[model samples]
Target: MAQPTVTDIRAYVLRGGGADYHDQQGTHWIDDHIATPMSRYPEYRESRRSFGLNVLGTLVVVVEASDGSTGFAVTTGGEPAAWIVERHLSRFVLGAPVTALERIWDQMYSATLFYGRKGLVLNAISGVDLALWDLLGAVRQEPVHEMIGGAVRDEQRFYATGARPDLAVRMGFLGGKLPLHHGPAEGAEGLAANLALLADMRAAAGPDAWLAYDCWMSLDTDYALRLARGAAEHGLRWIEEPLPPDDYWGYQKLRKALPPGTLLTTGEHEATRWGFRMLAEMGCADILQPDVGWCGGLSELLRITAIADAHGLLVVPHGSSVYSYHFAVTRHNSPFSEFLMMAPAADEVVPMFHPQLLDEPVPTDGRLSVSTLDKPGFGVRLDPGLPLHRPYPR
Candidate 1:
């Protein structure tokens, strides 16, 4: 039988009640820190939710094959991604052989160079790339991991990221990484408060459970050093994204200054193999955390992981849910995955994407069974009930 060709590429902007799951005042990364613009001013921080700041929106990409088999994926991009998909990327996808994803990705990346080498364009590209992988998996009647290289591990253990580490411990998570709630702008008092919170979580999580801090790209070198130093006594496994992602020199310095056993991790906001190359070459971090959704999807993540592996660095992807789960289980470097506690109170293991996706898998006892993801493609379907908007209607 002849291979199926992509007949159409369609992008949808999904927005509505369930879209803004992270929009709550305390839910955002910035809200945890007082120095960020969103939290700097009392009025803004207090009224963020009421001001309509919590917009849970995403861009969903669907690739339809000549044989009517459809594969789809979603990313954090909103209306802008929809425009790029419909106006610019569609040409690279439509009528192309589903097996030519590598060529298609290169064409799309090269063609968008004038306007995009990173950020939103890459996000849009990521959505499309993932959809292609899903399409190929469905067409070949194989899971994505099997299509790529097959599993390296039978199941994936996970660490919970949220307000409660004690609860995570009770639930059997490997560890808990808390969002740091202070920054340099808050001065010494804030720094003290930051350590106090970690200490509390440490006491609750006990000595053996892995405890880490997610600085959320809000701290300077000095602030991060102080926190890491303070956290060491409490048994911090690592400190993540303390400095801005672009501050390579800062990262190098921070890595050097940190305690010998303390690990520095970044790359959740970084993109592509080239960007990660900088991190590995400079010795900027001990672990690399690339979000498959944001770091050019699984296609690029495979490249990024290879680069990290060559350097003996770990590639624990940020909270990309199942997108990261499939890849994590297949690689030795990605020993554990991150499960963002998306329940309104951060108390339950609800689907990370919530109402936007159906049949989405959630970790049980802080681990996910590999067998659950054996279904063709990524194994989750877009919830049709969630209204999809085509912003740039053709």
Candidate 2:
């Protein structure tokens, strides 16, 4: 059978939480007192939004084939990303065959290398790549996992990321990852407060439930080591992203120094196989956590995972919702996926990209059956009611 060529590519930006889960309204645990790079300033310490964390909004990409079938994806990159898509990346996508993903991804990445080896441009490329995968799956009438490789397991287990680990334990999750609420700038007092909170959570969650801290790239190597030691008493399973994504030296030191039970993990903000290679080869982290929406999408992720597999490292993608779900179930190394509790209080299992997507699946009792993802593509539709704006059109 002949594959349809790409006919049109549309890029749109939307405000509020979708793929940019941080672009949420009102007071949410993800933003409240979460440690960050900007936490050195007293003004920005109280809220992440105070520093424009949500400035990127959401980038939506739609790839249309000559057969009139369209596949779309959402990621964090607002108007600036839409401009990159319509004015630049679309050239490689339009008129290409639906299955020409590797060529399309290479062209998009190479063309933008001068300005974008990482960050926003990569986010845009990831959006387009994911949409292309969706397009390929649609054209072939198959789910994405089937296209890449068949599922290795019948179900995908999940660990919840939120403020309420106790609630997540009750929800049947394998574990809960809490955001580290303080940073190095806060000093010893902050460290005490951090440990105290963990102790309280450990009491609430009980001893056997897996509990971990998501440092979110907000701690120093020394502080992270200290935090790990303090957390070891509470049986902390892991200390994730304690230092910034690029600090391989710090990661190497911290990983070696961490308590016996605590694993060192990072890489959500890191992009591409090249970047991840640094992490794997350097022995920087035990488990690599790349966001499919930011780490060059599924195409590059295939490469990243292969590298991890070679290095004997696990590739657990950060909160990418269904994008992670499809990939997780297929890979043996990705034994479980993450579910970011979107409920304002972090008390319930809301769809990770709520209001922006329809037919999105959430883990029932902390597990998603492979059958739940049997539908074609990613098995979800964009909520047409979203207030998406086209900043640039081609």
Candidate 3:
């Protein structure tokens, strides 16, 4: 039988809550009282609440097969990514075999070379690649994990990323990663506050539960070292992404400067295998946290995982919900998954992609059963009730 080809590719920009739901609001790095690097801007400094910069609207990609079957995936690229998919990427996708995911990914990456090696272009490719995986899984009548080599473990453990580490501990999570509310720009007082917060969380989380800080790439080498040293007394599992992803030299310095046994992790914003190769070669981090949706999808992430495994590094992908969950359950290197608290207060469990995706699964007591993902593809379906706008409308 002839292979089923991709008939059409479409990108939809999804935003705003539907009739029954209000727009989801959440806090960000800049929202903290401390003076962040973003505070340098008059608009941000004068009224931080007004800056809705962290509100990354969603971009949904749909790939249709010749058999009338369709698959879709979502990421935080919004209108710009929609444009990339509609204008630049559709050519590479249309009429391609549903199983030709790697080829399609390579073509998209190469076609956008001049303007798109990373960032939004990669995000677009990642979304499309994920959609292709979903399509193939549906066509094969199997789940994504099976298609990727089946489950390495029957159950997957998870850590919670939110304001309430104590709450996470109560929920039976293995660990809790709190966002750093202060940056270097806040000076000594800010540093003190940051340490104090960690200290409080450590106390609340107790002695056995793991505790970590996500600096969100806002700190300098000096700031990170100071934070790590301060956090050491509290038993910080690791300091994550203190500096920018591109600063390999800084990462090396930070790793060297860290107190003994303190680990460094990054790559949530990094893309592709080459970027992760730099992370491994430079000895930049003890762990790599690549978001599969942002890091060239599952195809490229498998390669990234191999590199991390070879280098003796842990691959705890940044919070991509189910996309990471599927990959995590199948990789030995990815021992735990990250669940970003989407609840308004960050105190309760809620679907990570709430309102946008239906049939999405959330961890029960900080652990997810791989059996829940037995459904074909990524095991989540888009909410048809939610409006999806095609900005480019090809």
Q: Which predicted model would earn the best lDDT? A: 2
lDDT of 1 by residue, 172-264 (tens): 998888877777776789889988988998888898998988877778898889899988999999999988889999999999999877999
Kindly provide the TM-score of model 1 when superposed on the true structure, using C-alpha atoms. Answer: 0.94
lDDT of each: 0.84, 0.93, 0.84
Q: Runs in model 3 with CA error above 4 Å?
A: 16-23, 26-36, 39-52
- In candidate 2, position 369 carries an lDDT of 96
What local lDDT does model 2 show for residue 246? 83
> Would you estimate the TM-scores of all the predictions?
0.94, 0.99, 0.94
How close to the true structure is residue 2 of candidate 2, measured as C-alpha lDDT? 83
Could you say which candidate leads in TM-score? 2
lDDT of 2 at 190: 95
Which parts of model 2 are misplaced by more than 4 Å?
Answer: none
Q: Give candidates' CA RMSD values in order.
A: 2.3, 0.7, 2.7
